[model samples]
Target: MSRSRRRPGRCRNPNWFGQMAVQLDLGLHRLGFGMEELDHLISDPQWCAEMVPDLMLAHLPSGNDRLSQRNVADRDRFLKMTAQLSGFRKSVAASSGIFLGAEFHFDVVRPGSALFGINPMRGSANPMLPVVTLESRIIQRRHLKAGTRFGYDRSFTAEQDMLVGIVSFGAMDGVLFSPRPGQKISVFLDTHTAPVIGSGGSDTLFVDLSDVPDRACREGQIVSLINHQHDLETCAFEHGITEYELLARLGSRLPRKTCPIVLPPCIGKQGAINTRDQTSR
Candidate 1:
């Protein structure tokens, strides 16, 4: 289970580890295990540690003074229990808990969002490599006249005649981002960028390409929407979506495949390579 307490429903109550079980709750600041089933398993001398869950310290938010004190007290109690079990095997830490300190590190760790360059330590330096890079291909490029009104309910009105590129991404693609007031946002086009001038549509994204080179703005060109320079994080933060949710929201038509590195033919006619990132061995 996850060590960070956020979205309690996601990281809690997983029933798949084993019948030889261990359990934890992030909100409970739990590390040691003695769940109903786990206690029964541990009582049997024949049961091995490997059959249980990967034990790790998880954080629950400090809600109030009473809760804070209780969490600390409970953590101390669990620490003592964990110490007794320590020599038997090292436990594992979750994505965000790796930075909690060496005391939390067992032998193994589950790299969740951390595997995708999300800062394990929220305010600290990110130590992971870039995992997913999102891009969209251009399908058409054309000129927009001044006073042009477009999009659903005519949400966009051109201030001047401008050239725009119709990229192969849209609301259905999970790229419809709502910018904060007066924010300057753009997309990566070759060595430069093109500004997004309006709300993203359902099947196509509109980018201002009036000043860009004609060749670079041509059809079939791939433009990066998410990149390594903290772009993924920025997008998630600004759009008020969890990192995992943002990634999951992307369209299914784009290239994505799970793997053990089997390079089979692409999916259908529009298939793209799935670049699932793994921590270096």
Candidate 2:
């Protein structure tokens, strides 16, 4: 992944080692970093003889087509290599690798992003559940003429008689600046879609609500900032940002709504004050 020198903090995928609960089998990337880690752990003959890997959890080189000839050759090499190691139950294809099909899924398969509605198949249709849905209330609505300028340095201007809502999300909320002159990123309000106008302040960005009905477009109505139409993938691409980065940066500052499931209560750890009591300190 290419990175910029200026802002070194871009969102990226998590580097998970391995977990048992998901039955993901064992895997590694960067040629599966764990493979080296395991080699280190089991280097001693005593430890090496005792340690038996259940599977070779493998990682594919990024930006390669899953079904490409190169990937096929690489997979063949990985499987052949694993053959030298006895007693493993099966092989496992990591999240994206599952899209490659039965060959990649020997005994187990791990599906991470697929659980959260991300498209497991690159450049293909998404077939997973969308676990997240974001919403924010409109703080203000303004009507402007064609010449009226808006935002930082008046970067955007009204094209005609228009209405816009100052949404409660901006730089402070981790919203990136517009990537170019005419890219279209948007938010959904009920059944209607509204295009983003521009950023106005550290705490807000504008959305074109001209086509929305007055009652629905008024200030204080909550609007969906993300949905199927302006899905995470589409928005990330539109903004010249990485999907990993875009997903990571958003909603960090937003308040969490009440969850559907009630979590069990927790007692303070010996003498530790509850969050409610700490504020008085």
- Please report the candidate that would top TM-score against the real structure: 2
Candidate 2 lDDT score at position 275: 24
For model 2, the stretches where C-alpha displacement exceeds 4 angstroms are 1-43, 62-64, 89-91, 129-131, 159-161, 177-179, 255-281
Q: What is the lDDT of residue 8 in candidate 2?
A: 16
**Predicted candidate 2 versus true structure: per-residue lDDT over 1-281, tens digit per residue:** 21111111321225633421111213323233233344443444543343345555565553125656666765675665565556665544556676675566666665666545567677666655355566788999898998899888898889898998888877777665344576677788888878887654678878899999887877889888666566777677787776657767875688766445222254344323442232221
Count clashing residue pairs per candidate: 0, 6
TM-score per candidate, in order?
Answer: 0.68, 0.68
